[model samples]
Target: MNADLSRLANYLNPDKKKLAAKGITSVRSRVANLTELLPGITHEQVCQAVTEAFFAHYGERVDAEVISPDKTPDLPNFAETFARQSSWEWNFGQAPAFSHLLDERFTWGGVELHFDVEKGVITRAQAFTDSLNPAPLEALAERLQGCCTARINYRKRAKRC
Candidate 1:
């Protein structure tokens, strides 16, 4: 189903070739599904909702270059995302205000994931042991799509279930 990410992703890039190459062809409706869950909402409404959420989450406190959902596979989960977005390095890495190095070490599911974000971008990264080091990141990327259910229409739930 099309949710917010897929809806906006399709709107931003209508041609299927790039999406196919990146193996993300089905995201369009995924975005649609998210907003449609809210009664009377169209796909466009979902995009606006997510964008508003994004801005609300990161406004005033930081200068975000682009709030685009991570299209890359293996998006990070909420904890990882909260950490990433809340970090001083990720938030001010690109700012002229200050420059500093960020270091963190954590283990999840028997694997250690090490990451550093500088200048609002990932600068250093490494994964130890398990291969799902990327899942957290992918989960984070898909956050926008997951956002759709936040305001789903109560009646629609009965109809679908």
Candidate 2:
């Protein structure tokens, strides 16, 4: 399926929230049915139809925000995060094996991240903050894990962070 259709399916499915709250096994049955149903209608025409239907049902709830460029959040300290790591051979193969250990401190937000990466994938991530509520930092760290550094669209993702 195309990226747009995949995104639409994810947006349409209420099971995403359920999957996050409940475990994968808890939603396995429904997911199987959904998987069976999705492919038949993933074509461009069906995607358009589904999009129209979705907007018809839920258009009132959709809010499009227009934030000014000057108000954008500062980009995370990726350079410092990547630089602190000590590289090593992860495995014996023709592919270059490397690992990175990253510890970054954000001066403005008082947020810190300790990330362990192997073969360009974050294997472990931990976040720390002086604030009593660390939810946002923790959430950010969780989202960073398994993210390919080269593939990340920093400008797009920074706004959410």
Candidate 3:
């Protein structure tokens, strides 16, 4: 979670705000509480007035945002997969990547990842773990074979970036 927060902090800041139609007197402090508060309605959603707040907070501070972690909201599946931390191991693990060179690490309880591509597949890869089964990573690589539109699957995320 800390890693995810820090990653988001690179892109978000909380102290910035654009004033509404009101004059300079209400630049930071808006005229009246600009957000609409409901009566007995606990429905949670940011009023879009606090985009700065979203940028201000990175991880746990997201709890303070109207958006709840329980809901996936606008995050992509792979990103959400990386964000939620089930334990300290998940939160503190190293980020693996294959750039000009294949980069990975062996940490305590790190899951070994294997990649494979076939059927005009240009990439074949494997990893051995002293842990559980390896079918899922294999399947994921297979799913990307037809869609290898980029150099690698992680590269798709870079497109969005």
Candidate 4:
């Protein structure tokens, strides 16, 4: 989560936005290597080259404008909202209610499972079996409620059964 926030901060940082404002008229790439592009491979050299490239691509000569990060305004609740919206549960847990069926045959009997799913988790479970003992099946159905349908999660939960 910290990594995600850091990435968003870096990309949306004022310094990066200032660089973007300079605008690119064109970008022509030929068969070239990084060594050729930056002989020194230093931060200062890279910044200088990139700054020059922004103006060099254009036919008309224009003075480069200096942008202040302090002057840039921040959006309200953007980071928090973005973090929430990008979460796994927010994206996948909103799935519509559905039902799932699984049938399997063991040495003792054949079992059929019916599950009511909501928001990607099991809300209810019903099990039918041809075996004499139905206690295990009832217990299994009770345990299934509130379990997620994801294969890995289901596998971990199914271990008890």
Candidate 5:
């Protein structure tokens, strides 16, 4: 009825050989479950045991920081903000020294901006609008190439379009 916690520990620890040498070989096959163990273990005791085990196995001390839940900063409400913006939807991808894409969709128009991040400039841009005349949007897209997103004046840019 008991789970194989030694195997679990071996799987969790980076150094399996050192873990096996400690008397944890089978993790007491008779204990019947983790629920029973939890009643007797404190969080700090568990942390100290793991830290001691890690130091014993690796011969290096491990430092851990404990932060209270109250000390953490509140996260922004992105979903509420996204819901309020009915006219546009946006998505972006990022990675170091590689091509990144920024796609934005307006209720009546859309724009896709591609960048060569390693070279620090826009490589391509394309726009779509419901208007029969697409030349302006297309030209705007063309003009936007080689510009950096961080420096763009969106309000001024929109006025031109």
Candidate 6:
């Protein structure tokens, strides 16, 4: 059965509306009963079917090209390219500012830590506690400033805190 794909895309994820606003077209839809009817279908079969449908629809408008599977494409700057793409600055440094909160209860008292994060670093931190002596918590909040919140850095710094 055919479905209204644009409506289905909006129904599935409202974020696609932003894609449309940015002049990016999205082909978003799902087949519901195909797998139930043919449970033994292989990944190659699905790819072939999708490829055939795409070529048929776009017929003559698209040029087809194929590269041999055995040929290895030359990439001279592979190491540099990989390093840049996989770096934390490339991945999370562009993220918008946000706040994270963590709450814990210790034998002495309960403590809540709030972090204001920007550019993948903890810009500001605050700690609230019911403990009679809050000096340790204050020091921890101070230590968190300017610390990278990436998983590896956070784990190392958190151990010290």
What would the per-residue lDDT of candidate 2 be over residues 1-161, giving only the tens digit for each residue? 33434345534545666777776433333333333556655466665677678778986535444334334334596444443432322231123335544444555556666766556566677778887677867777777778765556745654566
Question: Candidate 5, clashing residue pairs?
Answer: none
- The models' CA-based lDDT, in order, is 0.48, 0.56, 0.41, 0.69, 0.58, 0.75
Superposed Cα deviation of residue 160, candidate 1 (Å): 52
Query: How many pairs of residues collide in each model?
Result: 26, 0, 2, 0, 0, 0
Ranking by TM-score: 6, 4, 2, 5, 3, 1
User: RMSD, model 2, all Cα superposed?
Assistant: 19.7
Predicted candidate 5 versus true structure: per-residue lDDT over 47-145, tens digit per residue:
688799988999987576543433433448644544454322222223235666667677756666555543444666666566566687677777777
Give Cα distance to truth, residue 151, candidate 3, Å.
9.9
Q: Each model's TM-score?
A: 0.18, 0.33, 0.22, 0.43, 0.32, 0.50
Candidate 4: stretches off by over 4 Å: 1-86, 155-161
Per-residue lDDT for 41 in model 3? 33
For model 3, how does the per-residue alpha-carbon lDDT over 51-161 read when each residue is reduced to its tens digit? 546656743344442344565456567445646664333543333433222334455333444544333333544444444644554554445444332335564532443
Candidate 2 vs 6: which has more lDDT: 6
List runs of model 2 lying over 4 Å from the truth: 1-109
Looking at model 5, residue 67 earns an lDDT score of 34
Tell me which of candidates 1 and 5 scores higher on TM-score. 5
State residue 107's C-alpha deviation in candidate 4, in Å.
Answer: 1.7
Best of the two (1, 6) by lDDT: 6
Tens digit of lDDT per residue, candidate 4, span 1-161?
Answer: 01233244434434545455766221221124455565647666766778778767875657665434333235787566667876769876889999989899999999999999998888999999999997778788888888777633655555677
Give the runs in model 3 whose Cα sits over 4 Å from its true position: 1-5, 8-109, 112-122, 125-127, 149-161
Instruction: Report the alpha-carbon TM-score of model 6 versus the true structure.
Output: 0.50
TM-score of decoy 3 = 0.22
lDDT of 6 by residue, 23-58 (tens): 766546233445566777777788778888998887
Which candidate number has the best TM-score? 6
